[model samples]
Target: MPATAPRRRLTAALAVTAALTMGVTACGGTTKDSAGKEGGATATGSADPKAPLKKGLTVAYLPKQVNNPYFTTADNGGKKAVEQLGSTYKEVGTSSGTDTSGQVSYVNTLTQQQADAIAVSAQDPGALCTALKQSMKNGVSVVTYDSDTNKDCRHVFVSQASAEDLGRTQIRLLAEQIGGKGEIAILSAAQTATNQNTWIEFMKDELKKPAYKDIKLVTTAYGDDDAQKSFQQTQGLLQEHPKLKGIVSPTTVGIKAAAQYLSGSRYKGKVKLTGLGTPNDMRAYVKNGTVEAFELWDPAQLGALAGHTAVALESGRITGAEGQKFKAGDMGTFTVGKDGVVLLGKPTVFDKSNIDEYDF
Candidate 1:
């Protein structure tokens, strides 16, 4: 169900008061109701779709974790976008990337603070639904990025890339490295991660293609997005499947950890690794031959897009409905897709040749 309308009215008033206390201007002008069917628009019944969100609204970005390099970089992008838009920007999250319970508490706190919007990378799609639903009802525009929450709980999801694209890319890369024929395994992040599961499902579908028939999937292991745990899991995979020739770790943490484990083992030159990873984290491994190539979207760009989406939702420039359009600052204009999702772009393949071109 959508957020309660009466509750949003109360929360909006409280948010305006909070904004005044902070010496920030609150949102003005009429806004469409939760159903996107009332108020807000010109005399001709049209809205200025490219207008910026109201100035001075507070936007809090809550990543999956605080210290993780990936989230840190992404949050920094969000901070830059928010500040540039003349809005208050704050970031808060758990130190452990896999802590869903901790993320819930943080969401509740942000809602209590009456933030204009809360952009988050959920640890689990379902675990944070209640808190996010409450946040939405409290007039906090909820936008999920990187990892998403349930559809009913958030206004929009800024996806890094299409699930089918990411899945096909990772498997195709692995197939090339493994000579298109060998036993391969998957080293995934959290088992319940919505994005991870979606990509993995598509990957499974891709493997069914005739070109990949020679490649056999040995097993899939969960890393929980922890370095130590992922490292240990990689070791376990090697031990359990001595003939494993390749590994696809779609999570940044898992990919880095798997590369580290492979770098020192007898499989250094034997086992091939590829997945979604930032160039910096995988640079050394790529140079030393532990990893040949991997794919990932620009995380900073993803974050900035999410930030822009949050503001757009709060300001009513565009409701989270399919075909609604809005401008996202320098990143250009975007249109809301099915299920309230906004795609950043396609993933870029990072290899030794192009790794130097990317700083993040």
Candidate 2:
């Protein structure tokens, strides 16, 4: 199942319950979720947990782009969290084809909309810093996800996984596939991506171990997370280094593109592809034997954690400091960390046998 399926069903349930009860319910009942899991409700359970019951407060979630599968799944988590809190939630951002200018315009529009809080995944952290700062000036709570605008502009960041953890994990996976020998190339995102660069540096550091002494990093290419560009880069790397044994693509788009190219060429089984990707995006590649494994966290759980954390902080139940713990609804509990950022959990590796079990 797609990651969005469960949340979509939850949304439908909320609507149906509202209609049947006219937004007023006895609050005690048993409900079945999209996964067919049963949930018990108390008599006082809010019909819409995130209904903006405060009367004048509004929250907006802005992904890097509106139609991207990853962000769409994340928005569902945010909406579910909103429902749990009885607050109103709106998803605002550019469409799938939008660029940086369009994202900036969306930020400005949200500001004009006078949203009480804005959660965004900035396309260009530096470029959007100014707009995020302005939103702060307008008394909007600014939180960033996937990509952060900057520490100074945003109050909190929802990171999927730690940079070092992801980088080290990718390096380990690549080394294991190639027997720790031969040349490998890195197909990363844009040069300015804060997360990607950090991961690349960690990969280099991890490759220096004694077990990886024979492994050599030949070159790194930037695909900016564009599928076509990643494909072209993968082809170029093959020509540039005929001895290449493996390729690591830290970006989801780059990883899938590399897998697609490798699957159709002589590189299948001769070279390995490992990085971050969704189960749906990499299912065929893994089954066709082009990719051995990849790593990622649950986007829904990450978004749910962010939503709950935001609500907790806004409600004065938790602070963006050490020793603070709050419930993330179905995501469990998390603690606040330094720099006002919260990491979801460790990266998980998915291979052919287990890929089907993961939805995000």
Candidate 3:
């Protein structure tokens, strides 16, 4: 059930950087995010779709850096949905995924250990929004999966898709592998990652359409997600664009350190690489051809829908508004669109014919 692509509606340009923040890209440094709003999280309750999931209640994952196999398969899929809804799952963070003051002191030590939901992944986006809106004004339940924060810092954000469908599907999968034209470039991750600057503003509004009018784009190399600065910013973007034909790297540690610097240089298979990686870290650079496709999602079903949307927002069943619907047990019924976000869909692209049928 993790192969998606059709569903789009949440519009009106919902800001607070409308959701996105995959994993495996850490190391830090960058700020300047708060454009006003600070602390005071509101949203009291009343959605009761049979409100039954409220067991031992503790849920605290907080990622952006940890033992790191993609946030350890998304905090072990939020410790398998907070131990299958009986709750009480814990994991804390900060090894420098832009250590926003160690993710604001691990959200004040998981709100002084009263932990009733944290699930963060932000590393700036208003510098952890006043300690996650004061850990939702002390009652906890914040939920901001994979790299988000700034819809006034969390209450619901599980998104892994539709930042204009992952920036026009990473520029239509690198303009269908550099055919529709040439000269691409993006590298990215940590220009104060508002989900890679909202998917590089829809990959620069999908290269202004017209079927990407002969591509172009040419520069943008940030690699602060560091793997020796994304292998020396993929060798300073092919030595300052030596006619560079491709690259997108929307960060899975910048497309496996720019596919280990184009599978050991001489631009293996002559440039052309796509963004967002991890099918076991781009399976030997897509079996030695140095990547021809890429995309992501199913970081263990995006940490099991951010552990069933933080146990369905502490089981009043759903309160994060915008068409609230619930049930995520077997990974199904999830609605709540618009700025409360919740969109785990449309991502799978891999390559080498299904990238060996996926594993990460």
Candidate 4:
């Protein structure tokens, strides 16, 4: 639901991510209530949408994991938009999605480079706060996409869509696939990933409804956003819960890997699987009868919007205030909602019938 980061992935290396203790609630979250609180680095001037977008500005992008194909797609989209707007675009980050130290270091480096702005997909909600606040204090605008930092750390956050929407939809999709009665488990990315955790929170809340009472949540397994690890986790889930009716893997990496395991095993077709995934990654599995459908927004569109948001911030078009709006190039106008968030749009469901129409 976040990115293709299959391009929606993060990792167990939460251990490596500032050595953060691995637990969803223990670590800080990027909820709007907290991000909306005043006091942190922010744009103080009023927005001027008609102001000429300043050219030749340096905008940096730091994705969660550099090598993931989905992130690569999202970054390229940003590069395209930034260049179109007459700004310079470059990317920097660690190869590992869970490298919190690398992420922090890159933020510091971007600030030192005197970059006009930085677009990041935070690895941890709070671990990167100090560094990000320092950047804001240095007059560098920070915009987060895909995942978010605490509202206090950055000037703006570009989310794929509402956290509640992404989370609740996964549960609905799985219930339909499993006939509304059976065991289900969530396969997630890093424990500290704000996006993943937020979506999971809504998923759990949705399950509390009477419509989903028949469905029992068995457990949530962490795959650390690694292919082999995800595959192993899927296999283990089945081994441990022979009655497991379905799996909801929110990250592209997790869903694809789970699809891979189910495709080759006896569970193929018998077990339902759904979550965020890129069309290309899931096409084979969908054709093979391992999965019925999955969901994601165009990661490129998400990145491009972020690029425009960053440029707008530097150009003084908006100052991260609720109700302020800006045009995102050809994508259209977007409004800054609560917590300085700009949502890309709703999730799109891709199945065998329409998967071919999508390429990214």
Candidate 5:
């Protein structure tokens, strides 16, 4: 959540006068009810599509984590949208280290609060499917931002770019730094993550071209977005592959962890670090010489766009289709794809000269 609200006095009219004892729910969950629809858009007792979004129309944003500055920026974006739209939007999540259970609990809580809509940066597309499906069943409009959820449940996905673009950009960045011909290693997030897997596969295919054949990718490892684990993996790469010239981490946490480890070591200038990292996380590394450059999109803009798109869908303004343009406040106009998907644009390469200009 953005900031916790202290408990306050409640009028008797609004109070739970009769304290009915309910069983202890799971961590991060709320009391459940079964009288709701499954994956469809409309629910029986929900607010009408044309109903004006009032001041307290709650919209919840659940991200992969809350500690990274990237998600913080995204929260700020959602906040701006809330202010502009005069609605209630809360940004909440586990601390990057937790499993999918906490998010499940969060979804239950949103359902209890009867949120107007939910925008999530899903940790696992599969694990969160049941929870999201349940939420949608209970009259919540579901949208995924930064990352994605299972296709059947989510109404819209705010994509940052295609995996092909991400993988190609990282390879191009490393090749630019290492003169295009040397051994490279991939330090990825997890084995099952959809985004990372797709990007890595695209990177592998891109490397087989004539211009990139000279650039050999020696090894690949999973860091699971753990800082210490990523650091150890970086060290192991240095030890095991003496000729390794670069390491690419498709996940933000793994990229920053690897960059932090390389920034302080003798390999600072030797093995280059490039992947999907925020400007704040990699600012020092880019300025010092540990990383020549890295790639990422504006995640806050992504969240905000997702919020607007979900509202639009709820209001019957647009359907999920290719070439469908829509306005995203402060983030400018965006087009919808074949799957109600919206791209936030290409990966931006940040360096010393331009890093300080971007807050996220």
Candidate 6:
């Protein structure tokens, strides 16, 4: 990928403009603490931001699960970032995608291992808050990516795209697919997922717009990010709403599973489907005419951004404060925004004509 990719360039330009408008000073200095650990230095105070106890920090990435292609590609990006920074990297999680408690257990263990920082894609927002808060209290820098926990529980959140953008984009795509006047349903990952819930809210809000006034959202189903469960839920959606014109699944797992169910069913071409999906996962579906198009940000880029953010937090280059800037390897400098959130960029729409250009 080009260093000045369109998304990165746009984000960088916007970040610079926001920083100047906010009058936020760049605080990128480090100082040694009593324990000889390097920590971030505040611009106007003696207070030192916490940092790793050792150099070449260890960053543990805990996604919703292991072996899921979405997370696998994401973690691989993190691994590359860690390698470039000469940091120790480890990826750990449960095989069950929606196992919130299982993820908590992993957080506890990683905390016990004295990992320098933890980068996570939360399965459930509130379920992981207590564990993440405790991890932060244990001197571990917590960075949530993909799906966020409570804002107070983590240092920074690496968001793939703004919720409004993702939600509105999905709805617009579905509306176009269904001729802008039909009943559509949503197939989401987990009911408690923060990102999914937020995007769903925005989707509902987008439907209220005049352009989508003719479209009606029929129902929503939770797939728990499990292929079998998602497949069953897709079947249920079709069976319960035979006249449903389209379905939007904002999760990679759910979308792929929904596509599988649609491809093998009688409604293959009758009911339209569109949402956030990877090129590779939806390629066959697009080729078979089971799906027309979908949209998603690069998960690998999101992971790499998260990895760089974790390293910055652990190494004391930035304190996760608004306007703080840090270099994200080849992605360039990113500024922390309000609520300690860092936007990765915009989502990309993928279809048969250009799907082959992307591998992840």
Using lDDT as the measure, the top candidate is 4
Q: Is candidate 1 or candidate 6 better by TM-score?
A: 1
Worst 10 residues of 5 by lDDT: 13-22
lDDT of 2: 0.71
Model 5 reaches what TM-score against the true structure?
Answer: 0.82
The CA root-mean-square deviation of candidate 1, after full C-alpha superposition on the true structure, stands at 9.3
Question: Model 5, which residues run further than 4 Å from truth?
Answer: 1-55, 319-323
Report the C-alpha lDDT of model 3 over 1-360, residue by residue, as the tens digit. Answer: 457423322222122111222233332433222212122223445577786787888787878777656776767767767787787677777666777787787787767655677788886778888888776766677888877888867778887887888888988988888788988889887788778888898889879879989888978888767678888988888888899889888888888988888899888888889988778778888889988888888776788789888877766677676787887877789887777788888888878877766666
TM-score order, best first, reads: 4, 1, 6, 5, 2, 3
**Which stretches in model 4 have alpha-carbon errors above 4 Å?**
1-44
lDDT for each candidate structure: 0.81, 0.71, 0.76, 0.84, 0.71, 0.80
Encode model 1's per-residue lDDT on 1-360: one tens digit a residue.
001111111111112211211222343433323424221111112345755568898898888877677877777778778888889888777778778898888887777667778889988989999998777766677899998887778888899988889999999999999999999999998888889998999999999999998999989999988999999999999999999999999999999999999999999979999999988799999999999999898777788898898888877786677778888887888988888788988888888877876766
Two-way TM-score contest, 3 vs 5, winner? 5
TM-score of each: 0.87, 0.81, 0.35, 0.89, 0.82, 0.86
Q: How many residue pairs clash in each candidate?
A: 0, 17, 1, 7, 4, 0
Number of the top candidate by TM-score?
4
For residues 48-83, write the lDDT of model 6, one tens digit per residue: 334432348788889887777888777777877876
- Model 3 scores a TM of 0.35
| Candidate 5: tens digits of C-alpha lDDT, residues 150-223 | 67767678887876798888988888888888899999876666677778889999898889878998889988
What's model 4's overall lDDT? 0.84
Clashing pairs in 6: none
Q: Which residue ranges in model 1 land beyond 4 Å of their true spot?
A: 1-52
For model 4, how does the per-residue alpha-carbon lDDT over 1-360 read when each residue is reduced to its tens digit? 322324322222112222211111221322121111222334345678787897998888899988677787787788779999999887878778788998998887777667778899998999899998877776777899999999889888999988999999999999999999999999998888999999999999999999998999999999878889999999999999999999999999999999999999999999999999988899999988999988988887888899999988888788888888899987889998887889998998888878876777
